[model samples]
Target: MLKKSDMIAMALGVVLGAAATVPAFAAGGGGDPPPPPTCAKGQVYSAKKNACVKAERGALPDEEMTQYAYALAKQDRFQEALNMLDLLENPNTPKALNYRGFATRKLGHTEEGISYYLKSVALDPNYAQVREYLGEAYVIQGKLDLANSQLATIKTICGTGCEEYEDLARAIEDSKL
Candidate 1:
């Protein structure tokens, strides 16, 4: 027979195991439903309706649009990402700027990307992801020192164990070769 403590431990383990399988984006907004699968161009996933919907200003919250733009960037749809970002009512947010920088950088305009990253950092200096991306842009420009500086800043915002730190560190290291 299982003791009460053992039963509780088993339940906790099950919950944690399920959580571990969840995609990272699921945590973007507190308890945001799992994002729907990728929608075609000019469409976006709507958590409210649990389906894809035509992308339009005011159709979804800015946060959701930003999340969708970020997803587009991750999928290598840089132009689509920028178009989605344009739909945001206010595109000056740190996350919006960061996504713009990411898409711009991936599109081979490193200088423009750096400018966006700087604006984002100015808005939210503690955003480690922006620091990482800024460092990467520096690496692309052969400015290892600047990249390293951003890496150090990222370390201060989030410890070396953070994904941003690890990714930037790897980018800096890879630049050396």
Candidate 2:
């Protein structure tokens, strides 16, 4: 008889294989292709390739709620960004929460923004941009230790010369002022 650990490993392998094959068959039209994801405005249906195009133009949203929030944030209209964030189908999504947190922070709701930023980080710890913003928020609140920790993590994840790394570095430095 197989040992317990061996059985467990075999089960895990089967599950993983099934999971992998499901995606492959799904992509091959085993079912109808999923409906295209929508743009933030709800005015346009986005093809897969178009979902992240706006980021290339220095517009940060590029996908669903994020794009809407970015547009409002660009106008320095943080309340509107919050409103758009509220309208997202999946408000708990890290991207949505991150944008909302950023917008709220811009509007001077620092505590509320920090809460949302924390939520975003909890949802996706690997999201370097969210970590950067969380560090900025901590700095704004005079939480230097937390800010430094987050900044160090951002540096490690985003790479030394990346725009996010530079931005976080600047924010950290400015916070000391």
Instruction: Give me the runs in candidate 1 sitting further than 4 Å from their true place.
Output: 1-36
Question: What's the distance in Å from true for residue 155, model 1?
Answer: 0.8
In model 2, the clashing pairs are none
What local lDDT score does residue 74 receive in model 2, on the 0 to 100 scale? 59
For residues 1-177, write the lDDT of model 1, one tens digit per residue.
Answer: 999999999999999988886766445432444444679999998888988999999878999999888888889999999999999999999999999999999999999999999999999999888999999999999999999999999889878978889889999988888
Alpha-carbon shift of residue 2 in model 1 (angstroms): 6.4
Question: What are the root-mean-square deviations of the candidates from the true structure over C-alphas?
Answer: 3.7, 12.4
* Candidate 2 Cα deviation (angstroms), residue 123: 1.1
lDDT of 1 at 134: 96
Model 2 is weakest, by summed lDDT over 10 consecutive residues, at: 52-61
lDDT of each: 0.90, 0.71
Each candidate's TM vs. the true structure? 0.85, 0.63
